[model samples]
Target: MFRTIFNTVVIAACFFILTALHAEAAGFKDVPKEHFAYDAVLWAQKYEIINGYSDGTFKPNEMITEQQFAKLLANYFELEIVEDELKKQTTTEIWSDEFYNSLASYGVPLNGYLHNSIRSQPVKRGVVAQAIAHLADAQQNLNSSIEFLLEHSISTGQNPKYENRDLQKFFGSTNNMTRAQVVTLLYRMDSMDFYYISDDAEAIHKNEDNNSLNERAIEAKKQLDASLQQNPSSSNLWNGNYRYVYQWGKGQYERNARYVTISSANSKDFYVRLSAYDGKYEGTTEGYAVITSAKKAIMQESIKGNRCIIEFEHLNNAIKVTEIDCSAERKNGTNFSGTLRKQ
Candidate 1:
């Protein structure tokens, strides 16, 4: 009886060990892996487009820096860098390192707005869209639908907001993506197709007038030109007229300001002033203002210069403005002020 019991116990131990090993082997089976990104990473890694961490884990969560990403693109696309040419064009520091300089020379817009901060931020989906679109445009391999989407995406600033359901709808219910979709959207902005449909059939029919990719490109260019006219200066003084007061506080007041007349003929120069007032203790107003743009409006207050600087761009078919800095000086207790007009 004792021998039989011992033999049974040994068998049970073997069974438990085997089960544990099996479970361990299958542990990651249910984990949704980014196979497409993984494949890209592998290619990137092999080509030194990316590298793993010191701990040997590739923390994809880490923001991809603009500089690093530019280099990656340059390497993949074999872009050339012209150091002397870039230096002559802009005072901005071109990533002149042998690898990064190539990207700069490839007309990548590494100057002014396309600065280096892109590297430190986790590579956003929208950025991925832009990059991919750029690549497709360069290669002339972009499909008409993809081209339309890319142009619209950049002009309107639309980026992928990956909802699993949305992904499934676009990529199919398999929840798996082909290398084509992954690479195109990941590297080329011209990979996805997008359309704007209003709640009414009339709007849809009207949009049909500009349905083709070429038409869309023309429209986008026109819009960009209009935008440039509106905001001629990379940094400019935005003016408006006071319309109605919205809110007020002890040292501050908010009002809707109208445009009296703008010095610049650009419509972007004209805005409905949502102004805030701070008492005469400081030369500047303690409140903020909102200026609407083709994509979105902005709310900002003065920090250091004569005015506050608000940064904006199109993303995901909308305008997003970020408050960059504020400039207000305290003078002998008088606020620097302006007005708005109706017509």
Candidate 2:
């Protein structure tokens, strides 16, 4: 009787170990129980795009850093790292040779803010938007394929819309995400059908004959207008300057400023001034840099010193900046200079 009991216990231990191993291999069993991003985490894991911590825990609720995300994307997409010296230099707070090259090779859009340092912060929705847009631009076929897959998934009942009544329960009573934007995202994912706006004479007369799409478009315009209102100078296509100061803590502060002006009329080029100030009196200097932008990507002699290039998407309002072999010099803990060209 004693021998039989011992054998049973040993068998149970082995079974539990096997189960744990399987869970780790699948990358799901270790994820936190309370993560809001559980679905996204599982999807990424299934695609072999991300991995859990070595300690058998997936910290799904934790914020991902910029460098970590860059590496993750680079590995998943099989981006190549260049071996040039300029590409390898790692002096600035944001500099990462491998990460930069990998991101560039993957056609990831680099904002003027991405210099040499990787930020340890939560990945924002806007970054996701930018990355997805870049991926869509890079592989046109991939976007359509993914879209079709999403459509099929939705059609097969994989995605279900929350009932209108449940919206308050799930999203809270005071949440401001418009019904239109929700429907639009869902429709694009094939999870929900578009809500039609009635065009009946009485309904039309009540609301000026606005259809659902028209109403949504108007809302979108309003939201865009509000954003522009916050940064009114950005509306000027030719010249603009904006500045903001933020306090972090005792003896720590920062001033973020940007200025754009016409650099050369002959080449139709524009120069942007980007600077960051630090400390109590804003007397301590952090860094200062200048970059140029133009319509074309080519390096025209008329705009030779500029190392940054700007391109507008077909939508016109969407802008992208690519930094080239720009250089910077620092002095007196407050003064700095750099040259960049806009493409």
Candidate 3:
């Protein structure tokens, strides 16, 4: 009798162990065990954060819509979608009204969401970065959110204008993000512990909340300050990544984003690539600027025989853009003139 009971117990234990080991294999026709997002898919499944389709297939490659993403985030975070947290604005999605309201109430950066046809549009990766950064305790702005993701091991995005790649990776990508990519991001975030800049440039984590103050932005500021001290007024020092976000309402405002890249610098001037992007809208022009002053450089282009001038001004930790009749190049109500902060 004793031997029979012992054998039964051992069998049960073996079954339990096998079940536990197979948990990571998330049962989906499309997701194989060797898939890069397998672990994330497993985690998302465990938490019911994102689920597969009814046909027993996870369409991991499907493009996620903006409203759908917003709702997914709200549910994943278990945020209270209060009705009173309403945002008085245009570009509202009549469907999934709660999700849109929650996004506004939560103060998540409204990057491409504010663009027209909010319901049918796909959310940009920048929007994803901003929302995730907010949850990770970063400031509620595009630049800060982007810096947070980079500082944290969440993403690696290099502007395509500089890189040879066709599509921008990470937060800079204007392309629509896939469902699997987002799931992988969430999985990394949930398992991430700390944010530390290592000498080897590898991902490191320590604290759970990551409340430790971000030192990268601090270090960058210090470096710029030191450079300024060395040369009080130098346009050559202005070669760095800078971006800005602007918003306007009710047919009377400007809602857009601008990014400028300056590189390959000499003492006199440097190469500049000015790009404007907001989901479906984009305009780009690159040219060499000969520095005529310590804080300003101007580029001239003729649009339809009308001379258009673009000015770049170097300020302390910021770059100011001023355009004279560059409207022909602007799209989706984007104005390239604004105060952009260093990333």
Candidate 4:
């Protein structure tokens, strides 16, 4: 009888422990136990992907920022943010370099959110969908993310208008995403049809082949050779001073009177000095001492020395700057297009 009672008691204790764990998994008072998102909430909490507020409430409707979501994804993937790398990217100093680099490394498109001060703003639902779709290797169309959600039956279309309610509620692409919604989407990422596998033999082989520094050097040399073939000669491209007006959008332009003066050149580095004046604000000078390559040059404003990525397309007497990302240094509305010509 004593042995029988002990065994029964142990069994009962085990049952209680499991029941308590299930309850704790989705225990937020605000989230009903029978809510559709209850299981996803439980899964996220179980794996520490999210935490509740100090008051023990998971405010499901609260919006999440890009940085916050990025951090959560970083935690999920076990990627470490490299602070030094982020420092080298921008001087806006709003977000750490690691925050940007880590997201880029994981295939997140920084172009959508990197150009503005809106990184701290709440992320939109469409963007959340895009992130998930990209991770799942889904083909990205203009509406791919929205289509992914709809095709998977994750959301229904806009709610039908009812009497006395003219506002048509939509599950459209640009809707603001709530915390619960984002978590549910993340939970669904593990579904068999949506999950991405990194174990493909071709991918593994490519990764292994690219692992060597020597191999990367060789690839870069090949690119340089290819570029040289197209341009034929970069002989006069870097030796003298060039003047270019850096205009971005409809905003006040920058007067770069003496933009870049190359001092020396080699296969390793092309050292150059740059100078510019803010067209909107006279006497405001921005200068930079930078080392570039035959194919690309990057310059930062002298005041803070933030970064701007410059890609060069060398012509006979002029080097056309095809693209520039000077978002960190310039105010909104500055035109990003410009040309550099030998003076």
Reference-based lDDT, each prediction: 0.34, 0.34, 0.56, 0.49
- Model 3, 114-168: lDDT tens digits are 3323333445676677666655564445566667776777776756464444322
Q: What is the lDDT of residue 189 in candidate 4?
A: 63
Q: What's model 4's lDDT at 177?
A: 55
**Each candidate: RMSD to true structure?**
18.9, 19.1, 17.2, 18.6
Q: TM-score order of candidates, best first?
A: 3, 4, 2, 1
| Winning model by TM-score | 3
Candidate 4 structure quality by residue, lDDT tens digits, 214-300 = 233223223221112111123323544455654444433433332444433344444443444455442222333244655555454
| Tens-digit lDDT track of model 1 for 174-226 | 12122223333333332232221113322322345545322332322232211
User: Per-residue lDDT for 229-253 in model 2, tens only?
Assistant: 1111222232222223343543323
Clashing pairs in 4: 86-97, 247-335, 248-334, 248-335, 248-336, 249-334, 249-335, 287-302
* Candidate 4: regions farther than 4 A off: 1-15, 18-26, 34-36, 75-84, 88-100, 111-116, 159-171, 197-343
lDDT of 1 at 177: 20
Q: Pick by lDDT: which candidate is best?
A: 3
* Candidate 3 error regions (>4 Å): 1-11, 14-25, 81-98, 111-117, 158-173, 194-343
Distance from true location, Cα of 288 in model 2, Å: 27
Pick by lDDT: 2 or 4, better one: 4
